[model samples]
Target: MQRLSENPNTLLALYRISQAASSANTPRDAYIVIIEELQRLYDPHAAAICLINPNTSLLEIDYALGYPPNLPELAIHPGKGISGRAAFNGEPILCNDVETDPRYVKLIEGVRSKIAAPMIAGGQIIGALNVDRDHVDGFTEDDLDNLVHIANEASRVLQSVWRKRQLVMQSSQLNALIEVGQSIVSKFEIQSLWQTVTEAAHQLTGAGLCTLQLYESKEKKVSLQTVFPENLEFLDMVGDIAVTESLAGSAIRTKRQVEFSNITTPDYRDLHDVPHDSEVTSCLSTPMIYEGKVIGIINVFTRERHRFANSERRLLQAFASLAAVAAQNAELYSRVFNSEERLRKSERLTTLGLLSAEIAHEIRNPLTVIKLLFSSLDLQYPESDPRNKDKQVIREKIDHLEEIVSKVLSFGKAPEGIFTHWDIDDLIADTCLLVRHKMGQLKIDLRHHASSRKARVNGNKGQLQQVLLNLIINATDAMPKGGILTITTKVEQIERRSVVALYIEDTGSGIPENLVARIFDSFLTGKAEGTGLGLSIVKRILRSHHGDISVTDTSEHGTTMRIELPFVR
Candidate 1:
């Protein structure tokens, strides 16, 4: 002690300790420098600084020097060792003979004397500066006083440095989180966004696996969208958990964060489809809350049992919030895409309507000239005369020409239905009569039945007749070899609303599977000689009368089409 007071090295050591404490920019650096200075002051063989880990309530060797290379990184609890005792009590410990000290846990081969001083700042002990010497009684009372003073001065510098480092790290983490949020929100595809989120979560948390589970409202189920490692067995295990049973589900149900340290426990294993393995030990789950409701869950898995700190939990929650917003945006974009497709189809139909009008007008004049020439021929000249058969042939050809002109004229004309109260059954029977000849040509049997007291629909008489005509003709054309055509009318109560349903069924070779979808589309035809405008006209007339038509059923044996019109009442 006497030699140390006058020694030139003593003053040098004091100066070095002061400079180190002032220059350190982080708590870890300050700890290293403080321990290093203590070793120099006492000329110890080894040194270390043990601090309290707030989360686990344990003491950890944060920094050390001159110790065995293979020493374990962890240390005894806060009150277990000489250093831990001093740190916990905020006092200094002096041991002249370490072998006799119960608190001393020796790690060095020749340690005999030891001193530990609490590093106190803002009236709290953060850690302790420890020192060890090679000889017994090497550290005197003076050594304890001097080391305590040094530790006291170093504590203030360490706290300031630590706070600065914390701020910087927090700022960097926030910026990284913001960038991830931007990337997720920019994606319009749900699957792609989910993949990005899971990948980012795995990287951010240093976890072995990551997964996203989306909630289905209709089924009240949750489905896994993406998982790391691409493990089918693990996925199947996770899939077995009911939407209301797993940790992820708990987070969603409670609208809170959930964490598990040991997934291998029986409680967790019971809920999981696959037994927990050694590869997965810890889990963190957070709910994706949007509009005050939980829509999904984001989960991360670690290989080792880990207590997730508050910072990590907060970070995961932030990610989940961003994901919720991105998912909503993606859904909105999908709806817009479908609406645009419908509008495009409407525009195409409008163009076809304009072109058909022009062609009908141009063909009218030539049709009129042919009709006048056929009328000028006389077939009364005789059956014996060769000109008689020639004249008869011209007359029949003129009639066929007139029929073609009439059909074309009907297509180009605007719908002019005589609006009146009429029995739909009588109208259907009349329309079926007009198509009976055509139906006979194909060997088809046409039948009609009314199942309601009022088969009355408020619409144009002629338009309804036209609709019935188109349907019977189409049914007849569908079965060229003859089949059954049945028409039925009924009053339906759907969703508590009264509606009239007109059903037309045919046994003709059911509409070709591929053409079934486009049967109502204008200019879509299945027959080589069809005008392709019949069904289109039927659909337009129905829409004009505030009605809708849809295919009820189609199979190899038959096809059924249903038309629904809201009753006037």
Candidate 2:
């Protein structure tokens, strides 16, 4: 190193570079100043400043002078060329004969000599300061020594800017984390919760897109839930990924965060087969965990191979934590609402049972008296007379009334029917026997079909029978002119659970559209003669037994009702 008194020009050059470094906004800008001074001092054919990328552990060209237009922005790894060797070895290299030197990789034509020195910071090489000449023996030992000292000064400036940037970024991260915390506590809907997380990540990192994926824990699969700026063309290619083979899955398995600077060329050998669109260049996936369990993953995507900063990682991790809690709370709220709905249905069943018993008792006494009087007068008329036929008709109507009264009496019984594992096919067969005769009277054809397999459901037999009976009665009423009535039973999967489905289809004029919605409401009737309590009571019974009924199909041609009961595995 030359003293300021011995070399006035060197002092002036140092002052200019130092002043520029102090005022520049970034390391790149400072490098521009430093390289300019080096060019004037050594009079080389080219000068370039390269910085080490911590993510890739390679030297990245930050700024260059006199380089050819065709030169790509190639990463310089350890021992690849002169610059790479200097940066990797943490030393200075001065080659007066470029063609003879093995470390020299040809760049500009006619360049015969070059000198490179490592930029060191915190006892490690961070980059290389490289200069090339067009003629042999163009540089001296003094020039190499001079560049090394200047490179050290440049490294100090880079370290300062890096530290300052980190401080600002960390501060921003803290604020973003606080916002995420607020959203977690307040939001409950699944869509809204994921939207908040993506929006927060986009804003925090200034990334163009952020994706949220949901994990189906039972199925052990992950699927893309939502993407920010929903207009990407790659949406069609997004598909479910198995937990064992995904970058997000690794994070979930380890319960940590994973990042990829270049997903097109992932570092992990296992990810070589992972198919991602070319538009996504860099990505980071963090597991959304709650209570030490992985819930899902929040992914941040960029269109370029960006070295994700520490602040970005921290912010995303914070988001994952908050998002996981929000998801958990939303699911818990859903389960709670479902439970409350069941409780309300149970309460409604109890009230209806009490009311039905009161009405049945009042109607039974008068019906009994009429039956006794009719029996006394039955032998008075001649067997061939029309009066005798009319008397028989009245007696037959009395018995139907008695049956209706008996059904009402049964309504007062427990809603949770005998809890037993019974074959649903057998139950349907027994109930069809009661309605088969009535269906024949109306000339309505009946068809029954069953699956080859048997599925048993646990429920009260009487309550389930009553439910089937009510639906059959409605089917007969719908087709007074005689249409086909079909009942089909099968075992299927619902929400990943085994279930038994009983389908009742009637080829009668479909229910009026206006009345279909309210058909299960108490006292809402389509017929002019009777109170509409049959279907309402059926709904209550099915619900009490942990089964449900829905109108699966309906039109002018017919109506189909489907009742599903959970089956034991």
Which candidate number has the best TM-score? 1
TM-score for all models, in order of appearance: 0.61, 0.56
lDDT of 1 by residue, 1-569 (tens): 44446656556666765675458776766776777666667767877776666546677777777775654455667887788889888889999898898988766678888889998878877888888888888887877877776777677667778677767766876887888888887777888999898887876777888888887756667777778656666666566346766567677677899887778777775555322553788788888888998888888888876888777888889889989988887776565445334433533554465466567667767877877866765337767899888887877877786677667657755655566666777878776655554455568888888855776778887677767766776776678788899999898889998888889999977877788789888778877866576777778888878788888899878889999877655
- lDDT on C-alpha atoms for all candidate structures: 0.75, 0.78
Alpha-carbon RMSD, candidate 2: 18.0
- Model 1's lDDT to the true fold? 0.75
List of clashing residue pairs for candidate 1: 237-274
Q: Global CA lDDT of candidate 2, please?
A: 0.78
Q: Distance (Å) between predicted and true CA of 548, model 1?
A: 28
Candidate 2, residues 1-569: lDDT per residue as tens digits?
Answer: 45434766656667777786458776667777887888778877898888787767777777788885543456767777899999888889999999999888776677888999999989988899998888998788878877887788778877887776677668777877787678665666778877777787777778767887777788888877677767345444566767776667877778888877777664543642233644777788888888888878887878877887766787788778878877876776665445435544654675677688879989999999989987876566788889888877888899999999999999687645358888888888876654554565579888889867887888888677767767877888889899999989889987888888989999989988998888788777888864567777778888887888889889989999999888865
Model 1 residue 124 CA deviation in Å: 5.5
